[model samples]
Target chain A: MKTFEYRTAAGLAAGLEPGAVFLAGGTNLVDLMKLGVATPDVLVDVNRLPLHEVSGLPDGGIRIGSAVRNSDLAADHRVRTAYPVLSQALLAGASGQLRNMATTGGNLLQRTRCRYFMDATMPCNKHRPGSGCPARDGDHRNLAILGGSPACVATHPSDMAVALAAVDAVVQVDGPAGQRSIPVTGLYRLPEDTPERDTVLEHGELITAVDLPALPVAARSTYRKARDRASYAFAAGSVAAALRVADGLVADVRLAFGAVAPKPWRAYVAEEALRGQPATEERFRAAADAELAAARPLRDNAYKIALIRNLTAAVLTALAEDVR
Target chain B: MRLTVNGAQHHLVGLDPRTTLLDALREHLHLTGAKKGCDHGQCGACTVLLDGRRVNSCLILAITQQDAEVTTVEGLGRRGEPHPVQQGFLDHDGFQCGYCTPGQICSAIGMLDEAGKGWPSAVTEDDDLLSDREIRERMSGNLCRCGAYPAMVPAIRQAAGR
Candidate 1:
């Protein structure tokens, strides 16, 4: 491993620096560095500085600091009660040890779990600029179909992030310039051309917290992940659903998918299709199909089409039945 | 950086900045109780307690934990008196190679604390706390390559006295 200088930042202002990478849990960054995927000359440790807080916001929402552990957030009573999808998503990922170390901000900032990205010998645009994505024609069973370009087809490997996007969470960030909040939907950008740039976070910018707006609708939420294994595995297809029913019909619905897109794919079209409609298995199937209509699967990832549709329909049916 | 490890305060300096808490504990401090399997945090062999919360030591920076209280497996049980979880693991034969035992025990302590605090797991209802499904879901992160899950469950249940 390459040696790097490390500094402990006193606060957010002290942490922002050129060529310095902010270290939260280091679960992803350290693993990448060991694999020669990411080699920073300097690491600015941000695990301290008093950012680890999970509290209720004045606007009846919740503000979770970037340093808050995934385990803590998942265990938070308010999150469990109001946003069960978020808690379930967090729990579905990694292991107890990892969730304890992984922070909400780090979970969002985690890189794609594409095998090509990790293997330095492989040609991956997301890892090495201008190299190209080998997974497009290679083992792409786990690659993305939505919002992917010829340059890259890597899927975002975050369960919590997908749930957060489904609920329209706001990411609070601090940078050398100033502080600002970006909607979680707008945080991730499509591969388009620059697969190297995964998120809209600026240089020297640090994610301070994530603010999830109050949605009573999300009180009846669920997250379901289907993977190759029953436990401790990455998702092949996952769905996060936050639905509200009124008068025997769907009042509101927020749906997002993982392992099928470059970012968390919010099923806005499906949500629109469900509004004011009777909550039925047939309607859920239709909504799932509507959301996946635009999916462009690769040569080997065609199974994701069916996997996503079935998983989405199952999650929606469970939500409709109020089965948690 | 100064930290309280296993109730003993130790001052460390001039260590590798990129060195993880796992490396610091096992390599530098000779606290070899926490094993390093799959150093990528996928395995729970390097689990430890930081400020009463269980975390994968492989993912934590040594410098980032300045002055924090750390508990390793060595600190978890006395030389003669083993912790309830440790005793339970031994009684239930929760390991074959015993490589992931320290992490499993450390994680179980944290998991029991979470259950005691009325924290609900994924399958838990919004109103209820600590169900069998919740225990299983919350404990899913720890993997036993030896396939000792059946024994591990009973061990954890005994430790939690559920």
Candidate 2:
């Protein structure tokens, strides 16, 4: 193994080292390294860099530091009370030991746990640029169904990012050009032309924190995931939603699906269709159908379209019952 | 890289950055109490206490934890005078080939700490009761391939002193 030079981040605006990747909680990075998928020359230690904080924003939202552990984020009082969907999603991911080690920014920047991407011998476009994506016609039962291109069809395996996309969450990044913020929805890009890039982040840019806006609608939110088993499994299909109903009319809603697309697939089209409409299963189905209509599922993952649609309706149905 | 593992400082010079903490503990420090079943964090056989929290040691690089205080299964207790979880495993027959026993013991200790700290599991809806189902869910990380769960649950409950 080619050991890299080690450095620690000095502060929030630390000096960036070339050929470096920040190491927070090595849950995903180290796994990829073991599989020969990622071989960083410099592993910058950022665990003791004083970025662990889950403070409240002036806008009544929450500002979670990038180094905040997933277990701590789920146990936070503010997150559990205000954004239950976020807590639920975090709890539903990985195992207890992994959750204890996984950080917020690490979770956000986690790579796809796709079997094909991790295997270096496989013909994966994401692993090797311009290489044929064998999963396109190979065994891809858990691959992407929405916003997928011919080059790649891997799903983002983070349950936390899916919930963040549901709310107005903004990702904070510190780079050589100073600090800048990007919406969580805009942070990840579809693998249309660039299948190698999982995110829109620059080479040396570091994610600092995530700012979730004041969303009272999230009080009645829920995150529902369906997989092969009950625990320690990635989602086959997942939904994170906040539905507010008024006299049988959909007052407001936010929706995002996981394990179904390249990024955390936010159902903005579904939200647009559900607004001002009656809070009924028919409306929910139509909104989900409208969103899934554009889905180009591969041969094995065509079931995800129906699965996501059913999960959307199910989560909305449970939330609608809360109104009654 | 500097690693203070189980109360001893070991400065491993020229070690590969890809060398896992599990390797540092077992190979370098010669603390073979922690097993390496999967080495991919799936089986959780490399579970250890990293700064008071249980984590898969195989998933962490030794150099990345320059300032960490690692506690392996050897740091828990001895054979005759065993830790509560170890004794529970012995008393309740929580092992078959005894390969995943160390991880199960350490994970049980971490699970108790998490439950005491008001951390809820996916199965824990409202309260943090140490039910059989809750224990199973919280201890899901440490997989006993011997199907030792039927005996493992009571042993974990015994370790928790309930």
Candidate 3:
């Protein structure tokens, strides 16, 4: 470990210093540093800056502080009531001890669970610049197919973030330029040529909170994750769905898939297809097919095609029966 | 920086900024009650109470919690007087190596707090209130390598008196 200066910031301005990394929860950043992936010379502790709060907005939305623990945010009554998908997705992630330490902001910024990214010796585009993605031709069974570029195919591993994107949540960020909000959909950029850049956030910019807009459809939401284990595992492919039914017809629908793209893969095309249509297995299957039409799978990832299809069908079927 | 560990207040400076709270408690503060298993956030061996919420100390920076009150396994009880959770674990034989016991106890304490707040788990229905299944689902984040989950439920339930 290298020597570094540690300072506890009093406010966002105090924390956003040059060459200083804002430390919240330290779940992802600390682990990356230990793996020799990230090495910061100065750490700005933002845990005490008073961002840890989860409250209901006057507009019937919810404002979750960036520093709030994943466990707390997932269990919050407002979140569970308004966004059940978010709660379920959070619970599907790492064990209770890790959820207690992981924050909403950190969870959004967590790196991919790619084995190549963690192993420094491996040739990974996400970890090493210009080294190329080994998973592309190698064991890419878990790699992304939707928004991947030729540079990399690493999938975003956050379960809660996918649900947030599906519900059109807004991420509040604070920096030297002042405060601004970015839609969760725009938080991440497509791999394009630079797969190394995971998020659109600028350096020194800190996430303040996530504001989920009022969505009545969210009450009829569901999140289902498919992984190798029954617990304590990352999703291989997951679906977060929010649907509203009126007179046995789909009035509104929103769907987002995780661990299938560089960011949360929202099936807007699929949602549009389901809207104004009768909620039936045939419609659900068509919507799933439409959403996965753009998928470009590599070798050994043919299983994701069936996995995502089944998950999408199951989540939509569950939501179709849920009362708004 | 100052920390009150095991009811003793210690003010120290010039420590590594990247050092984890778990390492600080074990290496510097000499409170080795919390063990370090994975160093990554996957394992629960470094669980401790920071402001009454159980957190993986290995994932937290020592300097981040300068003024925050911390409670380790050692602080939970003295040699003769054990915490209810600890006693529950002992009665249930919740460990073989005992390395994960401290973290399990601390995480259970936090899990009970979460359940008391009426927080829903993954298996919770939108209309249904909490049940034993919800409790188990909520507590799934803490893993026991020894496969003590079967015993853990009764131990936590007995400690929580539910």
Candidate that would win on lDDT: 2
- Tell me how far the alpha carbon of residue A206 in candidate 1 is from the true structure, in angstroms, after superposition: 1.6
lDDT (Cα, tens digit) per residue for candidate 1, span A24-59: 888899889888888888888887668899988998
lDDT (Cα, tens digit) per residue for candidate 3, span B86-109: 888888877777778888888888
For each candidate, C-alpha RMSD in Å?
A: 2.1, 1.4, 2.2
Tell me the interface RMSD of every candidate, in Å.
1.7, 1.2, 1.8
Evaluate model 1: give its TM-score: 0.94
Q: Is candidate 2 or candidate 3 better by TM-score?
A: 2
lDDT of 3 by residue, A1-324 (tens): 555677777678543556567777778888888887766777777777778999889999989999999888887878877898898899888877778778899899988888889877788878888888888878788889888988888899999999999999999998878888999999998888888889999888889999999999898788999988777788889999988888989988899999999899988989888989999878988988998999998877767878888888887887776563
How good is the docking of model 1, as DockQ? 0.64
Q: How well does candidate 2 reproduce the true complex, by DockQ?
A: 0.76
- Each model's TM-score? 0.94, 0.97, 0.94
| Chain B TM-score against the true chain B, candidate 1 | 0.93
Tens-place lDDT per residue, model 1, B1-162, is: 776799898888877777889999988899999989888888778889998888888877787788789999998777878999999898899888888899899988988887787765656665544455566666776777988888888788888776
- Candidate 2 residues lying further than 4 Å off, grouped into runs, are A15-18
DockQ per model, Cα: 0.64, 0.76, 0.68
Task: State each candidate's chain A TM-score.
Answer: 0.98, 0.98, 0.96
Among all candidates shown, the one with the greatest TM-score: 2
User: Candidate 2, residues A1-324: lDDT per residue as tens digits?
Assistant: 455677777676664666678889989988887788887887777888767999989989999999999999999989988999999999999988899899999999989877889898887888889878888878889999888888988899999999999997999999777999999999998999688999998887889999999999998898999999878999999999999999999999999999999899999999999999999998999999999999887878989988888999999999999998
